[model samples]
Target: MAATLLFLFVFLSLYGSASCRLLQTPLLDHATTDPIDATQLPTSVEASPAQVQEVANVSRRELGYYTTSCETGNPIDDCWRCNANWESNRKKLAECAIGFGRDAVGGRDGEYYIVTDASDDDPVSPKPGTLRHAVIQSEPLWIIFDSDMNIVLKEELLMNSYKTIDGRGHEVHISHGPCITVQFVSNIIIHGIHVHDCKPAGNAMVRSSPTHYGYRTISDGDGISLFGARDVWVDHVSFARCTDGLFDAIMGSTAITVSNSFFTQHDKVMLLSHSDDYMADKTMQATIAFNHFGEGLVQRMPRCRHGFFEIVNNDYTHWEMYAIGGSADPTINSRGNRYTAPTNPFAKDVTMRMDTPESQWQSWDWHSEGDLFVNGAFFIPSGAGASSNYGKAASIGPKSSSLVGTMTANAGVLMCKAGSPC
Candidate 1:
C-alpha cells in the first residue's frame, strides 16, 4: 500500500512540472519573436547592424543633428557614410539617387534648386496656366521653386499617404492665399523650407466656413499649418516675416512633432489652437523640442490654444514680447524650456502676483491650470526683486531643474544680430 501511494505522489509531481514547462514555452516564444524585417518596416529603419543593436539609435538620429558633410558642401551620400547616422544616410540616398534636390535649397549637396519663373508649371503635371488647385492629389512629389516664385493656391496642399514635400531649403517659398488649407493627410513631412507672407482671406471671428472663414481671413495666415493631419513631422524649417503665427496645428492633428526649427517676425511663433466650437477628442499629443525663437523682430512667443503638448529643450532670446502664452488646462505639459529677456520689469510681477506663484515661474501656465507635469530651467529677469534673479530655478523633478543655466543664456551676438536691440 505504501509503495503504491509513493508512486501516485511521484506521478502527480511529474504532471505538474510538465504543465509548468508548457506555460513557460509561450512566454519564451513571445520573448523570442522574429526580428523585424528591414524591408517590411518604414524607411526610418536602417538595414545596418549598428541600428539593430541600439533601439534608441533610430530616434536619436531623427532628432536634429548636423553631419560634417552637410557643412562641407560634399555629396550627401558621402556625408552619410562619414556621419554614421541614419538620418544623414537616408538624406544622402534621397538626394543622390532619388534626385530630390539634396544639394540645393537647404539640402547637403545644394543641387536641384527651384526656379522662380511664374510661367513654369508643376513638374509632375503641367497645367495650361499656373498650377492652382484647392486640393492636392499626389504623393511623394518634390516641388522646388526659386526664391522669387511663390506657389499660391486657393485651398489646401492636400497630400495622400507617404507623401513628402522637400523645400530644399529657403530657396522655395509657397504662399497659400487666404483660402489655402489642408485636411485628412498622414505620414507627411515638410522640412528644410522657409514659408511666410501668406494671408487668410476671411474673418478670424468665424470659427469654420464652407467657403470662407478663419483661415480665409488674410490676417489668419499660418506659415506651416496642419489641420486634421496625423503622424506628421515638421523639422529644420524656418518661418520668418509672416503676418500671423509661424507654425500652427489645429483641428485634430495627432501624433505631430515640430523640432529643430526657427521662428521669428510673427505675432505668435507656434500655436496649437483648440477653440471652443472646434472640439477635438483629447487623444492628440504633440512634441515641440530644441527650437530657437526670436531674431525675427517679432512679438508674442508661442500660444498653445489647447492640447497635450510636451515643450522641451528650447532657447528663447529677445522675445520682444511675452516669451510664452496659452490657455491654462490639464492637457499641456511644458518642460525644459529656457526663456531670456533683458528688460522684464514684470518678471517679479509674474513671479509674485499670480494666485499660484510657483506655476507663474514656468514659461507657460499649463501646470498651474492642472497639467500632469511642468518644470525646467528658467532664467529669472535681471531686475526682479527676487534676490536670486539670475538662477531661481524650479521644476517638478530635481533632474529636470538640473538642466537649467547649463543650456540657457542671454542671446549672444549671433542671435541678437546688428541693429537689433539686445
Candidate 2:
C-alpha cells in the first residue's frame, strides 16, 4: 500500500502538469478554442486491481495529510470546495462547472427554495416545502434540503426550468420510488443526492409547472431522465439499483455534464442518445468527467448515438462487460481516464461498437489518448485519416490519468457540514 501510494505521487508529479484539450464538435464551440473537424481523425492503436487500490491509497493519503485545506487536483472541486463558508455561498458552485456544460447557470440568478417536507403524497398539487413542489415552480430556484430525508415519489417528479437541486450539507436520499425527470426544460443542476432503487410509475396526472397539470404515460424508472433538455448538470450523486438506466439523456438533450458521481449494481449505466434514427440528436453534446464507475456494473457506461462526447479523467474500477459502448457513429474522445478491467477474459475490451459491422463502424471517430489500462485491458480505436488539430485545441484540459485516483477519490454524495468545506 505504501509503495503504491508513493508511486502515485511520483506519477502525478510527472504527468499532471499538462492540460489536454477537450474534444468538441462543430456545433459546440464554447468548449474548445481550436476545434477539429469530426470527419478527420487518427487511426487505431491498441492500449488493474492494484490500480484501484492505488486510487484508494492515494485518497487516504490526501485525507490524512490535508485536513485543513482540500486539493484533489479536480478543477471543479478546487474552485469552491476549500471555502469554509460554502453553505452560505452555495451559489458559487453554479459557476464552477467545466466542459460542455460549462455555461449551465442553474438557478444562479434565482432565490433559495428550502425543502422542508419530504412527502410526495400528491404529484399534482404538491405540498409546499416538499421537493416536488419546489421543482414544479416555474420561477428559478436554488433548492436545498432542511434535513436528511428519504423521499418516495408517488410519480416521476417532473422538473421545471432553471432549478438547482443542491443536496449538500444534508443526507438526502430519493429512492424506492419514481425518481426525477427533466423533459423540455433547461438549466438544471442536481448535486450530492443518493438516488437508487427507482421503479416505474405514471399513468396519472402530474404537474410539471405551477399552473399546468397533465397526464403522463409510464416512465422508464431511471434515476434521472433528461429528455429534450439543455444545459443540465448532475454532480456528486450516487446511483444504484435503478430499474432502467441510472442516467439517461435522450431526445436531443445537449450541453450536459455528469461529474464526480459514483455508480454501482446497475446495467446500462448511461444512455446518451434517443435512438439510431433520431436525426435531431446530432446536436447532442456531453461531458462525462471526474466520475467513478465502481463495482457490479455491466455495459454501456454510456451507449451513444449521433453526438460528440468527451469522456475524460474518470476512474473506471469495475465492469462486467465493456466500459464504453456506442453505435451510429458518435464522435468519442476518451482521454486521461483509468480503466481496471474485470477478471472475465471475454470482457477485457473497454470499447464496444454495438450492433454495427466493422465495415460500417470502422469510420467512427473514437480516439483514445493518455488513458491507463490495468489487468490486460485494451481499447480498439477506429477513425478515418489523422490530423494535427488535436494538438492545437485549447481549453481547460483534462488532468493526467496518473492523478485520476486522487481526483475521483470522493466521487459519490459528499458529506458536508454547515460551516465546513464540503
Residue 61 lDDT, candidate 1, scale 0-100: 26
- Model 1: per-residue lDDT, tens digit, 1-422? 99999998888787765544333322111111122121221211112222111221122222221221122111222223234343323344333211111112122233332334444233224243332211232323333433435666444333444444454422445655532244556655555555666665443333221232333333366666767867666655666655566777778776666655666566567766555346582445665644566554334345554455545445454454455554433134344444443244443111121232445435432421111111121322212322221121111111121122222221111111122211
What is the RMSD, in Å, between candidate 1 and the native fold over all Cα?
A: 20.2
lDDT of each: 0.40, 0.81
Per-candidate TM vs. native?
A: 0.51, 0.86
Best by TM-score: 2
Backbone clashes for every candidate come to: 21, 1
Q: Count clashing pairs, candidate 2.
A: 1
lDDT of 2 by residue, 138-223 (tens): 88999999999999999999999999999999899999999999999999999999999999998999999988999999999999
